[model samples]
Target: DTAVSQTPKYLVTQMGNDKSIKCEQNLGHDTMYWYKQDSKKFLKIMFSYNNKELIINETVPNRFSPKSPDKAHLNLHINSLELGDSAVYFCASSHLQTQSPSSNYGYTFGSGTRLTVV
Candidate 1:
């Protein structure tokens, strides 16, 4: 079974439109997050959710939002899409645990959704 999955592996659209990406995990993880990879392949956290509780990155724009209906899922919604938003969006999850390599708990990222705003 897949640990994590995301929809719309690729998205291409014009600017000024609103779009959303869906994510779900079956690993029974409590924490889920949305990460963005820019053209330079630099990854940055955008939002994190645990049981519907939202923790957003300070550098994330207000136009980006994450919604989690349950602990198993977290989705991202972007409003007024801009060209700068063009990047690969990844959804990931990790079980809640202390910082320890023996925990067997680490982030499992989805294949990613590539969004292109022209």
Candidate 2:
């Protein structure tokens, strides 16, 4: 069984369009994150939500939003998609240790969603 999963494995849209990627984790993790991997394969953290609360909001554009309806779900919404937004978006979940914030367990990543904006 897949620990983490994302819908619309491949998305192709035109510029100025809007898209949303749905993610879910069955591992019962409290923390979930959204990462974007560019064509060069450089992964950048876009957002992180812990227990339905926004925790880490990287320097991503305001057009990009992360919404967590519950501890097991984290979704990414992109507004006015641009060509530069073409990349693979990965959804990952990890068990965050409150006692030691840095001591987080390994993350389980979903099969990335490849977004192509023309």
Candidate 3:
């Protein structure tokens, strides 16, 4: 079983289409998040969910949406995708209650789902 997993390691689509990426974590962590790595390799938080509470970063677009069916999974669904939406999407998780050292506080990311829109 993987600690964190995301499906469709690579995705190529046309602009204005809609698609989704699924994520799951078996680490029993209470906190989970989605991050986007742009072409420039800049990592930015898109959404964070902890104990059923959703914390969204300010920079995310309305076209991007995140949903958590339960504590074990978080999925990303995009509507009217744009060329700019093409990027590497990563799913990660960490222990919420047990705070780890700075080193341990690092995210355990999925292999990454690469999205390319033409």
Q: For each candidate, what TM-score against the reference?
A: 0.92, 0.92, 0.90
If ranked by lDDT, best first, what sequence of candidates would result? Answer: 1, 2, 3
Highest-TM-score candidate: 1
| Overall lDDT per candidate, in order of appearance | 0.91, 0.91, 0.90
After superposing candidate 3 on the true structure, give the runs of residues whose Cα lies further than 4 Å from its correct spot: 97-104
C-alpha lDDT (0 to 100) for residue 32 of candidate 1? 91
Supply the TM-score for candidate 1: 0.92
CA RMSD, predictions in order: 1.6, 1.7, 2.2
Colliding pairs, model 3: none
Across 8-73, the per-residue lDDT of candidate 1 in tens digits comes to 899998999999999999998899999999999999989878864678899999999888888888
Model 2 poorest 10 in a row by lDDT: 50-59
Q: Please give the lDDT score at residue 10 for candidate 1.
A: 99
Per-residue lDDT of candidate 3, residues 1-118 (tens digit): 7789999899999999999999999988888999999999999999988875788999898888988888989999999989999899999998763444653566788999999999
- TM-score computed on alpha carbons, candidate 2: 0.92
